[model samples]
Target: MLWVKAFHIVFVASWFAGLFYLPRIFVNLSMVPPESVAERARLLLMARKLFRFTSVLAAPALALGLWLWLGYGIGRAPGNGWMHAKLAIVVLVLGYHHACGVLLRRFESGVRQRNHLWYRWFNEVPVVLLVAAVVLVVVKPF
Candidate 1:
Protein backbone atom coordinates (compact mmCIF):
# COMPACT_ATOMS: atom_id res chain seq x y z
CA MET A 1 0.00 0.00 0.00
CA LEU A 2 2.78 2.40 0.90
CA TRP A 3 4.65 1.49 -2.25
CA VAL A 4 1.58 2.09 -4.35
CA LYS A 5 1.09 5.44 -2.68
CA ALA A 6 4.67 6.43 -3.37
CA PHE A 7 4.48 5.47 -7.05
CA HIS A 8 1.19 7.32 -7.35
CA ILE A 9 2.73 10.48 -5.98
CA VAL A 10 5.76 10.23 -8.25
CA PHE A 11 3.78 9.61 -11.43
CA VAL A 12 1.15 12.24 -10.61
CA ALA A 13 3.94 14.76 -10.16
CA SER A 14 5.48 13.67 -13.46
CA TRP A 15 2.17 14.05 -15.25
CA PHE A 16 1.73 17.50 -13.76
CA ALA A 17 5.16 18.48 -15.01
CA GLY A 18 4.13 17.54 -18.53
CA LEU A 19 0.74 19.18 -18.10
CA PHE A 20 2.49 22.37 -17.02
CA TYR A 21 5.00 22.34 -19.87
CA LEU A 22 3.26 20.96 -23.00
CA PRO A 23 1.02 24.00 -23.31
CA ARG A 24 3.95 26.34 -23.00
CA ILE A 25 5.40 24.58 -26.03
CA PHE A 26 2.15 25.32 -27.82
CA VAL A 27 2.45 28.95 -26.73
CA ASN A 28 5.83 29.10 -28.43
CA LEU A 29 4.47 27.19 -31.40
CA SER A 30 1.70 29.74 -31.74
CA MET A 31 4.21 32.58 -31.80
CA VAL A 32 6.69 31.13 -34.29
CA PRO A 33 6.75 33.07 -37.53
CA PRO A 34 5.66 31.08 -40.58
CA GLU A 35 8.99 31.96 -42.17
CA SER A 36 10.85 30.12 -39.42
CA VAL A 37 9.81 26.72 -40.71
CA ALA A 38 12.53 24.70 -39.02
CA GLU A 39 11.92 26.17 -35.61
CA ARG A 40 8.19 25.55 -35.87
CA ALA A 41 8.82 21.95 -36.87
CA ARG A 42 11.11 21.48 -33.88
CA LEU A 43 8.55 22.90 -31.46
CA LEU A 44 5.88 20.69 -32.95
CA LEU A 45 8.10 17.68 -32.42
CA MET A 46 8.77 18.73 -28.84
CA ALA A 47 5.06 19.10 -28.09
CA ARG A 48 4.24 15.73 -29.63
CA LYS A 49 6.94 13.96 -27.68
CA LEU A 50 6.03 15.63 -24.41
CA PHE A 51 2.37 14.81 -24.96
CA ARG A 52 3.27 11.17 -25.48
CA PHE A 53 5.38 11.12 -22.35
CA THR A 54 2.60 12.68 -20.30
CA SER A 55 0.14 10.14 -21.63
CA VAL A 56 2.44 7.45 -20.34
CA LEU A 57 2.70 9.04 -16.91
CA ALA A 58 -1.01 9.73 -16.73
CA ALA A 59 -1.95 6.09 -17.20
CA PRO A 60 -0.21 4.85 -14.09
CA ALA A 61 -1.11 7.90 -12.08
CA LEU A 62 -4.77 7.41 -12.86
CA ALA A 63 -4.58 3.69 -12.26
CA LEU A 64 -3.02 4.15 -8.87
CA GLY A 65 -5.44 6.88 -8.02
CA LEU A 66 -8.28 4.55 -8.82
CA TRP A 67 -6.64 1.88 -6.74
CA LEU A 68 -6.40 4.23 -3.83
CA TRP A 69 -9.93 5.40 -4.22
CA LEU A 70 -11.87 2.25 -4.98
CA GLY A 71 -9.44 -0.49 -4.28
CA TYR A 72 -8.38 0.89 -0.94
CA GLY A 73 -11.80 2.27 -0.15
CA ILE A 74 -10.76 5.87 0.19
CA GLY A 75 -13.96 6.87 -1.52
CA ARG A 76 -15.95 4.94 1.06
CA ALA A 77 -14.64 6.89 3.98
CA PRO A 78 -17.14 8.99 5.82
CA GLY A 79 -16.77 12.78 5.73
CA ASN A 80 -14.71 12.53 2.56
CA GLY A 81 -16.69 15.19 0.80
CA TRP A 82 -13.41 16.74 -0.12
CA MET A 83 -12.41 13.57 -1.97
CA HIS A 84 -15.52 13.73 -4.07
CA ALA A 85 -14.89 17.36 -4.85
CA LYS A 86 -11.29 16.50 -5.64
CA LEU A 87 -12.48 13.82 -8.02
CA ALA A 88 -14.64 16.36 -9.77
CA ILE A 89 -11.60 18.53 -10.21
CA VAL A 90 -9.70 15.49 -11.43
CA VAL A 91 -12.32 14.98 -14.10
CA LEU A 92 -11.87 18.56 -15.20
CA VAL A 93 -8.12 18.09 -15.25
CA LEU A 94 -8.55 15.04 -17.43
CA GLY A 95 -10.67 17.05 -19.79
CA TYR A 96 -7.95 19.63 -19.97
CA HIS A 97 -5.42 16.90 -20.66
CA HIS A 98 -7.58 15.54 -23.47
CA ALA A 99 -7.95 19.00 -24.94
CA CYS A 100 -4.20 19.30 -25.10
CA GLY A 101 -4.11 16.23 -27.32
CA VAL A 102 -6.80 17.64 -29.58
CA LEU A 103 -4.98 20.94 -29.85
CA LEU A 104 -1.73 19.14 -30.54
CA ARG A 105 -3.37 17.26 -33.40
CA ARG A 106 -4.67 20.51 -34.81
CA PHE A 107 -1.23 22.03 -34.62
CA GLU A 108 0.33 18.98 -36.28
CA SER A 109 -2.09 19.19 -39.18
CA GLY A 110 -1.66 22.96 -39.54
CA VAL A 111 -5.15 23.52 -38.25
CA ARG A 112 -4.52 25.23 -34.92
CA GLN A 113 -6.26 28.63 -34.80
CA ARG A 114 -5.76 29.85 -31.27
CA ASN A 115 -3.24 32.55 -30.41
CA HIS A 116 -0.33 32.54 -27.91
CA LEU A 117 -2.32 34.47 -25.35
CA TRP A 118 -4.95 31.76 -25.38
CA TYR A 119 -2.34 29.14 -24.75
CA ARG A 120 -0.71 31.33 -22.14
CA TRP A 121 -4.03 31.24 -20.32
CA PHE A 122 -4.44 27.55 -21.03
CA ASN A 123 -1.05 26.87 -19.46
CA GLU A 124 -2.43 27.99 -16.13
CA VAL A 125 -5.14 25.36 -15.98
CA PRO A 126 -2.97 22.70 -14.42
CA VAL A 127 -1.56 25.12 -11.91
CA VAL A 128 -5.03 25.87 -10.66
CA LEU A 129 -5.94 22.20 -10.65
CA LEU A 130 -2.75 21.31 -8.84
CA VAL A 131 -3.35 23.83 -6.13
CA ALA A 132 -6.94 22.79 -5.74
CA ALA A 133 -6.09 19.11 -5.62
CA VAL A 134 -3.30 19.53 -3.10
CA VAL A 135 -5.41 21.64 -0.83
CA LEU A 136 -8.29 19.21 -1.07
CA VAL A 137 -6.07 16.29 -0.18
CA VAL A 138 -4.03 17.98 2.50
CA VAL A 139 -6.66 20.14 4.06
CA LYS A 140 -9.52 17.75 3.29
CA PRO A 141 -11.96 20.41 4.35
CA PHE A 142 -15.43 19.02 4.15
Candidate 2:
Protein backbone atom coordinates (compact mmCIF):
# COMPACT_ATOMS: atom_id res chain seq x y z
CA MET A 1 0.00 0.00 0.00
CA LEU A 2 1.07 3.54 -0.69
CA TRP A 3 0.36 4.46 2.90
CA VAL A 4 2.63 1.73 4.11
CA LYS A 5 5.35 2.97 1.81
CA ALA A 6 4.85 6.49 3.04
CA PHE A 7 5.06 5.37 6.66
CA HIS A 8 8.18 3.43 5.89
CA ILE A 9 9.78 6.46 4.29
CA VAL A 10 8.82 8.75 7.14
CA PHE A 11 10.05 6.40 9.82
CA VAL A 12 13.28 5.72 7.95
CA ALA A 13 13.88 9.43 7.57
CA SER A 14 13.26 9.93 11.28
CA TRP A 15 15.67 7.14 12.11
CA PHE A 16 18.37 8.57 9.86
CA ALA A 17 17.94 12.03 11.30
CA GLY A 18 18.65 10.72 14.77
CA LEU A 19 21.50 8.60 13.49
CA PHE A 20 23.10 11.64 11.92
CA TYR A 21 22.73 13.74 15.06
CA LEU A 22 23.77 11.17 17.66
CA PRO A 23 27.47 11.56 17.04
CA ARG A 24 27.21 15.30 17.18
CA ILE A 25 26.13 14.91 20.80
CA PHE A 26 29.25 12.93 21.38
CA VAL A 27 31.20 15.72 19.76
CA ASN A 28 29.71 18.23 22.14
CA LEU A 29 30.26 15.98 25.10
CA SER A 30 33.89 15.64 24.15
CA MET A 31 34.35 19.40 24.00
CA VAL A 32 33.15 20.02 27.51
CA PRO A 33 35.99 20.02 29.98
CA PRO A 34 36.37 16.74 31.85
CA GLU A 35 35.98 18.44 35.25
CA SER A 36 32.68 20.04 34.42
CA VAL A 37 30.44 17.67 36.32
CA ALA A 38 27.15 19.40 35.55
CA GLU A 39 27.97 19.64 31.88
CA ARG A 40 28.99 15.98 31.76
CA ALA A 41 25.75 14.91 33.37
CA ARG A 42 23.74 17.00 30.96
CA LEU A 43 25.54 15.59 27.96
CA LEU A 44 25.07 12.03 29.14
CA LEU A 45 21.39 12.59 29.73
CA MET A 46 20.92 14.07 26.28
CA ALA A 47 22.70 11.19 24.62
CA ARG A 48 20.66 8.64 26.53
CA LYS A 49 17.37 10.31 25.68
CA LEU A 50 18.20 10.72 22.04
CA PHE A 51 19.36 7.16 21.69
CA ARG A 52 16.26 5.84 23.35
CA PHE A 53 13.91 7.87 21.16
CA THR A 54 15.77 7.03 17.99
CA SER A 55 15.79 3.35 18.88
CA VAL A 56 12.03 3.36 19.13
CA LEU A 57 11.76 4.52 15.55
CA ALA A 58 14.54 2.23 14.38
CA ALA A 59 12.87 -0.98 15.54
CA PRO A 60 9.74 -0.26 13.58
CA ALA A 61 11.67 0.88 10.56
CA LEU A 62 13.49 -2.40 10.54
CA ALA A 63 10.27 -4.34 10.96
CA LEU A 64 8.50 -2.39 8.23
CA GLY A 65 11.49 -2.64 5.94
CA LEU A 66 11.40 -6.38 6.27
CA TRP A 67 7.68 -6.42 5.79
CA LEU A 68 7.85 -4.36 2.63
CA TRP A 69 10.75 -6.36 1.31
CA LEU A 70 8.78 -9.53 1.75
CA GLY A 71 5.25 -8.31 1.09
CA TYR A 72 6.04 -6.00 -1.80
CA GLY A 73 8.93 -7.86 -3.34
CA ILE A 74 11.60 -5.21 -2.64
CA GLY A 75 14.07 -8.08 -2.58
CA ARG A 76 13.45 -8.25 -6.30
CA ALA A 77 14.73 -4.74 -6.73
CA PRO A 78 16.55 -5.05 -10.03
CA GLY A 79 20.23 -4.45 -9.26
CA ASN A 80 21.97 -7.13 -7.28
CA GLY A 81 25.02 -4.96 -6.61
CA TRP A 82 22.94 -2.12 -5.28
CA MET A 83 20.81 -4.37 -3.14
CA HIS A 84 23.80 -6.13 -1.71
CA ALA A 85 25.56 -2.88 -0.95
CA LYS A 86 22.45 -1.51 0.69
CA LEU A 87 22.09 -4.59 2.86
CA ALA A 88 25.69 -4.28 3.95
CA ILE A 89 25.24 -0.64 4.87
CA VAL A 90 22.11 -1.52 6.77
CA VAL A 91 24.12 -3.97 8.82
CA LEU A 92 26.79 -1.36 9.44
CA VAL A 93 24.20 1.13 10.59
CA LEU A 94 22.77 -1.45 12.92
CA GLY A 95 26.24 -2.04 14.23
CA TYR A 96 26.62 1.66 14.87
CA HIS A 97 23.33 1.65 16.74
CA HIS A 98 24.47 -1.13 19.02
CA ALA A 99 27.85 0.52 19.39
CA CYS A 100 26.17 3.69 20.48
CA GLY A 101 24.38 1.82 23.21
CA VAL A 102 27.61 0.28 24.34
CA LEU A 103 29.48 3.56 24.25
CA LEU A 104 26.76 5.31 26.19
CA ARG A 105 26.85 2.65 28.83
CA ARG A 106 30.60 2.94 29.14
CA PHE A 107 30.39 6.67 29.47
CA GLU A 108 27.57 6.47 31.97
CA SER A 109 29.63 4.11 34.04
CA GLY A 110 32.52 6.60 34.07
CA VAL A 111 34.76 4.26 32.12
CA ARG A 112 35.36 6.60 29.22
CA GLN A 113 36.27 10.17 28.55
CA ARG A 114 34.09 12.24 26.25
CA ASN A 115 36.09 14.11 23.64
CA HIS A 116 34.49 16.55 21.26
CA LEU A 117 36.88 16.21 18.35
CA TRP A 118 36.82 12.44 18.48
CA TYR A 119 33.05 12.52 18.26
CA ARG A 120 33.16 15.05 15.43
CA TRP A 121 35.39 12.70 13.48
CA PHE A 122 33.17 9.78 14.39
CA ASN A 123 30.17 11.69 13.05
CA GLU A 124 31.66 11.69 9.61
CA VAL A 125 31.68 7.91 9.48
CA PRO A 126 27.93 7.37 9.54
CA VAL A 127 27.39 10.30 7.23
CA VAL A 128 29.68 8.76 4.67
CA LEU A 129 28.11 5.35 5.02
CA LEU A 130 24.63 6.81 4.86
CA VAL A 131 25.50 8.70 1.71
CA ALA A 132 26.57 5.51 0.07
CA ALA A 133 23.39 3.83 1.24
CA VAL A 134 21.26 6.65 -0.14
CA VAL A 135 23.01 6.46 -3.47
CA LEU A 136 22.48 2.74 -3.60
CA VAL A 137 18.82 3.09 -2.75
CA VAL A 138 18.01 6.11 -4.86
CA VAL A 139 20.31 6.03 -7.86
CA LYS A 140 21.16 2.35 -7.74
CA PRO A 141 24.46 3.43 -9.22
CA PHE A 142 26.61 0.43 -9.90
Off by over 4 Å in 1: none
Q: Write the per-residue lDDT of candidate 2 for residues 1-142, one digit (tens) a residue.
A: 6877788878888988888888888777666676899998998999999999999999888888778777887756665577788888989989988888887887788775656667777778778887888788789776
* lDDT leader: 1
Error of 2 at 14 (Å): 0.9
Expressed as tens digits, the lDDT of each residue in 65-141 for candidate 1 is 99988888875688789999999998998999999999999999988599999999999999999999999999988
Q: Relative to the true structure, how large is the alpha-carbon lDDT of every model?
A: 0.94, 0.82
- The predictions' CA RMSDs to the true structure, in order, are 0.9, 1.8
Give the TM-scores of the predictions, in the order they appear.
0.96, 0.89
